[model samples]
Target: MRELLYEILTSAGRRMNFEQTARLGNALGGLLWQALPGRRKLAVEAMVRHLGISKPEAGRLAKESFRHNARSFVEIMVTQRMDPRFLAEGVTFADPERVRFLAETKRPVIFATGHLGAWELQTGSLGAFEGKRKIVVVRRPKDQALHEVMMRLRTRPMVDVVPHRQAVMPVLRILRKGGMAAFLVDHNCTRDEAVFLPFLGQTAAVNLGPALLAVRARALVVPGFLVRAEDGRYVQHFDEPLDTASLEGERDEKVQATAEFYTRAVETYVRRYPEQWFWMHKRWKTRPPEEDGQPRA
Candidate 1:
């Protein structure tokens, strides 16, 4: 049943009649609501209130989302990419200054991102640069089939793809060549190396990749996000660079401080659009090991 629905929706992407589209949107909402984590149920419910959907409908929508989420990450991004119209009508990407820099920069700056809103759509703005600047995105490999599709999407002249494990040197090389690389720093893969920082009033394990690279390369570390807008347009928000040269210290301290700063920015942004952020994530994966122990360093 779900596969049939996906096939129909995929086929009707830009060809659906109004009634069919409305029905799909309603189904999509149901899919999303089901996926909401218990911690994020309030956020989902709040969205229902704001959108004026019935409580029952919201609950149903959330369940559908949880189910739909089983689709490959590339599939989700592709769907979002096809609907660039979403950025114009249903989403908001909120940065003006940093986006200007991305297009006009003499050398590339690293954009460290959290899983907030429709982040992939944020690069739609970069597409305008054409040959002048290239955007390379990092992805963790899931399976061979999904990996190939992701690579295909990244093959456009304006974009590049790098696997997370093998991406570091290549990413630096991109910046070395005056192209930009976006890194997602919200997930903490190694508990020992991550620092627990405040996020949505709770401690969340945060990664420090973007900051360290910014410091090592002496390049500006910019925090930017793409958020889902009400009218379907994305508001890509680019914040001014957080200077990391100031944190001249050992590698460990530098990484930790960087984690804290980015998480704070993420927390601030999440508060502005509480429901727009990806809260279902186990952001607070690392906690103090003992009652009196300090946050993992």
Candidate 2:
């Protein structure tokens, strides 16, 4: 049934141009906003607490975020029918010099990003500039049908997706080979796999994978995001790499510091474009043991 519904949606999406599909997505998002009042409220409350905005302003941002996210999803579906070359050409880098340097370097690189604008496209377009295959780390959907659907949409000639559960050795091997890997570091993680850090204006549990991989592999951790413009094109931005050399501590402490650095980088972009983030996620759901009134083990 889920596969059938996805086929129906993609079939309809493929018939429309990008603009038409985006309009349809906006309508769908509006309906979703109305239907999921609890999620909408969660997003609004998050914005108010983290962004320090009033309820009305947060509500506006939440609605816009839903629309933006829906548009991105429909766009992904539309991309299945579009030419990959054309899609790659539509993305431009914000800092060409930095990108060129990255492309020329032989060092392993780890791209740390969030569920921000055209994120799927961001990973897809990397092959155009980097001239190498990219290993993308992702949490696969538990439903087999949905997993197949996502794999079909995400698979590209120059991109490979590795499930998080089995990503450690694969990512490490790739990085050791001086290859590039991308991780979406914005999602809430399990307590056992997380390090508490300051994100936005609140303390949240952040995934330790990206930083741990970077530290262990001695790869450069580059904070990057792909933002959408009014013209529907994308601008990929790559910030300076985190200074891993300056981190001096035990292995765990180094991992903690690395996580903090990359988390701050993600926060900067999220604050600048609040509506582009995936706010429906319970980013702060996992609390520290002390906060939960439990002694640390």
Candidate 3:
């Protein structure tokens, strides 16, 4: 049933132009916003708490976010069916020199990204920037059937997917060998695997995996975001890389610092483009022991 729905969406998406596809997605998203009242409330409350916006404004933003998210998915479905060259052409880098330097040196890189605009395409476009280096994305959908469908959609030369549960060693190996790994770091994480940090004006549990991998592999941590342009294209923005060499202290402390650094990077972009982020997620669901009224360990 899931696969059939995916096929139906992608098949129909392929036949339409970009604008038409976006409209169809927006329509579906509008229906979703109306149907999923619980999720809609969650999104609005999050925006109100984090952005300090009024309830009405937060509701408006939440609605737009839902629409943009739907459109992003539809865009990926349509664009993935097109030629790779065409997809590459549609993405422009904010700093081409930095990208060229990374490509030329084949430096091992860890892209700390979130569920921002056109996230799938953002990660996929790395193949064009780094010619032959391995590009592995750590992702695993809960639904196995959905995972298979996404794997097929995300198929590109030199690109692979490692289940998040088993991502540690494989990602480290790839990074240690001068390859690239992209991790979507915005989702809520389990308490055991997360570090509490301030994000979007509130305390949230941030996964330490990306920073830990960077520190372990001695790779550059680059905060990457793909933002949609007025012309319907995307601009790939790469912020200054966080160098692990400068971090000093115990291994755990260094990991904590790295996690904070990347969390700030993600916050900057999300603040600038609030509607482009995935707000329906319970980003602050995991509370620290102090918040939970438990004694500190």
- Candidate 2, 76: how far from true, in Å? 2.5
Q: List the residue pairs that clash in candidate 2.
A: none
Instruction: Please give, for residues 112-185, the per-residue lDDT of candidate 1 as tens digits.
Output: 77666655444554554445545455655666655665455445555666777776677777777767767777
Off by over 4 Å in 2: 11-17, 78-89, 243-246, 294-297
CA lDDT of every candidate:
0.57, 0.82, 0.80
Q: Please give the lDDT score for candidate 3.
A: 0.80
Please give, for residues 1-297, the per-residue lDDT of candidate 3 as tens digits: 887987886676668876786687789789889999999999999898898999999999899899888887776665454346655677778998987777776567888888888786764667655455555565687888778767776666666677788888888778877888888888889889899999987788999888888888888888999887879777889899988867889999989998998899889998898888999877888887777775421
Error of 3 at 139 (Å): 3.7
Ranking by TM-score: 2, 3, 1
lDDT of 2 by residue, 1-297 (tens): 889988787677658876786798789889889999999998999999899999999999999899878877777765544455654566677888988888887888899999887676665656644566578888888898877777777776666788899899989888887788999998999888898898987788999988889899878888999888878777889999875656788988888888988899889999999999989878888987768775432
Taking all chains together, each candidate's TM-score versus the true structure is 0.70, 0.91, 0.91
Cα lDDT of model 2 overall? 0.82
What value does the lDDT take at residue 108 in candidate 3? 79
- Every candidate's CA RMSD: 6.4, 2.8, 2.8
